[model samples]
Target: MKYFAVFLPMLNEEKSKQYRGDHIAYLEEMDKKGKVYAKGRFTDGAGGLVIYIAETFPEVEELVKQDPYVKIGAREYEIHEWDMKVTEN
Candidate 1:
């Protein structure tokens, strides 16, 4: 599996709040499926990040498209394949 990072910049704060619960739920669902590596928000509140485990870019892209925040236009995102040269042991 490859790591795919979805860098989501907050767009509509109100909309985001409205769907925040659903968003987290979706991530948790994915995590249970072993589809998510990690997810977090920036302290500045400017955006958030979700690292996904997938075999192909399209798989991650599809996951992102299914995100509640993305589906509702509460956030804008760019998906990048992470190099991940280092990590905690």
Candidate 2:
């Protein structure tokens, strides 16, 4: 599996807030299906991050498009191909 980092920058807080429930549901569903590795929002509410493990970048992009935030244009995403080496818990 290859790692991907999705940077979610909130473009419209109101829109994001309006769709928060659906966004969270989508994240939870993906987590349950093992598509999401980890996710969280910034403390200041600026945006969030979602790490994913997929076979290719296109898979990650496709999965991201299904997010409510992206679907509604409440937020914009910058996806990066990531490489990580874990050394500590």
Candidate 2 runs further than 4 Å off: none
lDDT of 2 by residue, 1-89 (tens): 98899999999999999999999999999999888889999999989999988999999999999999999999999999889879996
* Model 2, total clashes: 0
Show model 1 residue runs off by greater than 4 Å.
87-89
Question: What is the per-residue lDDT of model 1 for residues 9-88, given as tens digits with 9 covering 90 to 100?
Answer: 99999999899999999999999999999999999989899999999999999999999999999999999999787877
lDDT for residue 49 in candidate 1, whole number 0-100: 99
How many Å off is the CA of 13 in candidate 2?
0.2
Clashing pairs in 2: none
lDDT by candidate, in order shown: 0.96, 0.94
